[model samples]
Target: MSQLRRILVDAFETEVALRRVFLWLPAAAGAGVVSYMAADREPSLWLLVPLTAAFAGLAFLARGRRLAFFLLCGLCAFFAGDLSAAWRSARVAAPIIDRTTIGVVEGFIEQMDFRRAGARFVLRVHAIEGLAAAATPYRVRLSIHRAPPFEAGAYVRLKARLLPPAHASLPGGYDFAKDAWFARIGGVGNALGRIETAAPPAPPGLALRTMMALDRGRNALARRIDQIVGGDAGAIAAAMVTGKRDLLSDAAKDVIREAGIFHIITISGVQMTLVAAIFFVGFRRLLALSPTLALRYPIKKWSAALAMAGAVFYDVATGSRVGTERALFMTLIMLGAVLLDRQALTMRNLAFAALIVILTEPESIMGASFQLSFAAVAALVAVYEARMAAAAADREDGLILRARAVEGERLRLFWRACKNLLARGPGGLLFATFCATAATASFMAYNFHELSPYVLIGNPLTLTVIEVFAVPGALIGTLLYPLGLDAWVWRYVGLGIDGIMWAAAEIGRLPGATLHLPAFAPWSIIFLTLAMLCSVLWRTAVFRAMALPLAVIGVWGALCGPSFDMAVAPNGEAAAFRGQDGRLAVIASRPSLFASEQWLRADADGRPAREAVKKDACDKVGCVGYLADGRSLSLVFDKAAFAEDCGRADIIVTPLFAPAGCAAGLVIDRDELKETGAITLLFTASGVARRAARTPDEDRPWSPAPRRKWGPSSRPFAASRPTRAASSDLDPSSVARAAGEAPGSVEDEDGDASPLE
Candidate 1:
């Protein structure tokens, strides 16, 4: 019987070795799918999938056991990659029924965007009630008519059509629809009134409502905390507790982004891992304190179980998204290991984690968090296992030489222990962190152009602190949680986090802390991913060393390769060039103050253009030119064009309408000039004719004229073309006044200049 069992075990092992090539097939497929989905111009070569699948199947049949296992790994990786696209597509196609009149909407605000004069938000509406398009709620990314003071939880109703969020018009541009879909947000809008008391209907048979309730409660708590502490500290505290970061102003957000410490506010891997580790350590320590209990049962095992419970709670508290999912999977595996009397950090455990993640949320397969966390774990496991195997071989060789020598056995055990410690020690931890950060950063750079230069420094320091502080704090928090003192402990924890926040902000201020790159190309992302995969897989020392540096350089080159920073004006015209400070500027022939302000605010990092102009005029037409400072733009307009002479505008721009003789410069028709994508002006007659439609021809021509005399600088410039000029040089206060006096008008800036200001 024993011999048969051994034979069967050996046979099973052989079968695994033989069939393993198929495992990687999913990974390969996922990768292919991801590539296909992320394609700027989706290829018509989908027929290649079937061919590849057939080829892979043929290869699997031809390969030996080792090759089969390798193939299996590829398959798994392929499937994981496909998850992003599948989830994204599902979200876009599935529309939540938003009952606009019923005042009920379900979904989350995926992100915020820029609006004309206010702000635009994208909501991934899961379900909506009392709306026209409730069958499958298509997305309705709402542009807030006015700037509403709100955050992710600020529920609102909209009296607008639900339109699909904009897609990437150009290749490799940010896809808003996909982003919103992946986030499960269906629409975006402002609050109907103040967030009145309302109950959003629950999704079918899911814990979404319960999770949302907790989120709302946490949001309330964060609001209260924000009120208690002002500035960054307050924002950090609120972020730590409730994960509400929108409470911070735009300036604060920019500061954090620049500093590269913005991740702390988001519920991320650090938070989940910290909380779990603390629970485990604390519970273990408590059990150990009770000597009798410790002696009777394994304390570490109990501690692991207790820690898992805490992780479960944390998952519930946070809504069990990607971060929570990863933590829960990790905690469960750890607890399972303790229960099963096996090693936690093994390849089997990694497989288990993968299975758990996929089973729980198939959508997570393509998520960066899932890929990064698992990849890092897998790498660590493989490396550790290989080292163990090497040590075992060394010990076996020594045992053969020593022939039952006690000294040799003792030495071997000691060396093994040392090797194990070395694998997980501070240096190893730092290396692991660096690798993970690099991996995640690469992935993000591919998806989002924003990459922090400070990560090289920030990640190590921040992770070290998190590693040191998290286990202890989490233990304390979990211990106190049972004793009804969790809140008090977290308060103190908040204090510690505040210190961390201070340090992060300080370090983030260092030079080279931030680097904004142009959006990545799909092919660049593919190449970067390939580089990482190669670095991870190359087993030879020389090959690995060579690969690592090459990969880094390659990724850097890909990131810094090209730029697409074109800014489009509200009128659907593209801005010609970036302003002096590298900002987009727009020149409007008849700039409505509100419209200019909207474009400026959206184009600017979140500041409005009106404040820089120093005026209140929302007259008929306004000319908005880029000021030298990237932060500000000047508005040029005519007072008579509207009705009231509201004294607002950095400078007024007017056409040169010379009646006595022909104007010195070329005359431009505003509409025709706008079409040329240049700064050209309309003739006095044409300008007056167009004005007649709005006002009456009897009313006066709005263009102010100096006739080379007493008024403002009447430079004889043709209104026929666009001209680029320094903001410091041009003033149009007199041109605005001249437009009201007579039929003649004066040109503002030179022709042939871009209307982009």
Candidate 2:
């Protein structure tokens, strides 16, 4: 307790800049709260407005304590701001939910992605036949069979089938709707026929024209790079320079991802910082060559301004993604500090950058890119500041220490040799790599459910090539693009890229190169983040020690065992049942690689899809199988199987309407699955419980409740007469009782049951 108290005192006594950084903490917390609330449920303007005003009033009243009061105000303001942002975002470019219609859609192509199978693009809708103006989606994503000459900003028309953005494929899986909601993508579909070019070629309005021009330039550069360095190498080079990663091969992506160096291809803080450094040094050297200008002006400030300009150019050249926006903002803040003659890389500067990003794009708080980028920066800044402080302390104590510590010449010489060996050679580089790897590994695992065990080896082996050759070569190539002389630079850049790819592939092929992990509960990430913040933000050794236990506890919780025993897809087309060996066996009637991958990744099961498939007694009717616990389950396809398995199987899953008098203890048919979305079943000694992808509380505009309608009833199946022989499975009485139903009785006459009920 005393040690903790001392740590707090030390933190308080730290520099004002350091103290100011902590003020952003509460504001971020508030933004995070609002983001989660908006994700789970609709934001109520009425409730948030009054709540914000009330907090503002309290903060005003507490103004005598200025720091605390301002902090409180920041929290409330950001909270309200985020809620308002979410509400506004939900209404923008609303999705068209009518999926049954196929019509001719005309729109301007805004972006294009070329996958191995085909090409996909996001189109800004101008008109849609057979649909009302208000009902038409603002933007639609279309997948076509082949790549067309349709560049970005080109108007085109095509016959397509449009539907609402996809929901989560499984419970706790990726939320495509949420991502699309923020990205302003309203609908997704496939192109049914050939795409014809529309007349106007370009859109009206100054902003649109400017964007079109920029995109044209980007396309030209990409083509030039492709011509210069053919194959996957050219694709990767183009991606590095222009953020056009669609052409990259899946094998290359896999190698990069497995090696944990995928960030190199993306324009992020590393690329932005490197660009700025290049500009700063180049400008400073050029200015120094002019003696009169160097003497008359503040050359450092001039260089900093030029560096800021360079960062802005790079931001645009790289497609200006959210990550690029963040990098630009931070770069601006650092250069602004130089302009104001203050320290550039201070915690307060980072906090200001974070504050600006959160206030503008509140949804970014939940993104993995935002979280991981900030984590790495925060860790580096904290370590740098602590090291600087320690050095200053050492300088102050040097005189007093020298008199007390006069050592023998031989011992002193030996100590100096050891220090030089550790501090100035490969040891230093290795240590830096270790710190960076450690700082990013946990967050990477949390977001991606995998870790690259060989990153420590991979990064150091490739860092020099990337820093000295690839980035610089790419930058030079981009600068020369206007003159059609980029090929000279690209040739060298391709060589460097080849080296990086080779290193990644070799390291990724090593045994146990990657470690996959299960999905972590939300609170686990929060706990780990808090622990990291405590360890880094505090100044004293005692505070770091205090955080150790918390870090350990968070890690343990994140790595805990899986919760449910079985997961059923929302469509009733597939299910994964856990076996006694703790492996998941997938029973899928149809091939759905997306859902299968999601299940495997979520379970952290490293097995391939072919290996995980369960060979069951499947036929045209359905498949019946026993789980690891001897719980018989029958997947019914048609009436024949339904009648045969209804009374015999412990649980029955069917794609058709539930037949009347069916006696399965638990039945998940099309109706229930459609209403609740995907579900996971938890098998305990007492009974079986279920969890739905969407709950009642998740009643947002994007996730509406399933509609109800009376339909023709299927033929009644007698429960007393079973065609199939009853296997030695768990009794239906125990399962029904655990579900809070009377033995041998259906839970609901309407066949509508709550997710778990």
| Best lDDT among the predictions, by candidate number | 2
lDDT of 1 by residue, 1-757 (tens): 9996776556545535634323334346546566645443323325444544655575577566655546554654554444434443443455532222234554554334322245445554555555555464544455454655554444444434343332222233333334444444443333343333234354323353454456555555555555555566666666655555555665666666665566666566667767877778878887888879988987888888888888888776654666557657766887778878987765555555655565445545555656656665555555676567777886677667577666647777677668667866866666665665665666665544456766655566556545554435445554564465556545554565666666667866786665545444345655666565545544434334545665666667675543322332212222212456655444544223333333333232334443433233223454344434322222223333322211222222333221212121222222221122123111242321111111111111111111243453323333343343333332345434434322111111111010100
The reply for model 1, stretches above 4 Å from the true place, is: 1-29, 39-92, 96-163, 192-208, 220-230, 281-306, 347-430, 444-457, 464-491, 542-560, 564-576, 579-757
| Candidate 2: regions farther than 4 A off | 1-27, 30-39, 66-81, 84-93, 98-100, 200-202, 397-421, 579-582, 587-590, 608-626, 630-650, 654-656, 707-757
TM per model?
0.60, 0.85
lDDT of 2 by residue, 501-539 (tens): 888888888998889998776567666776777666666
- Return the clash pairs for model 2, or none: none
* Candidate no. 2 TM-score: 0.85
lDDT of 1 at 175: 34
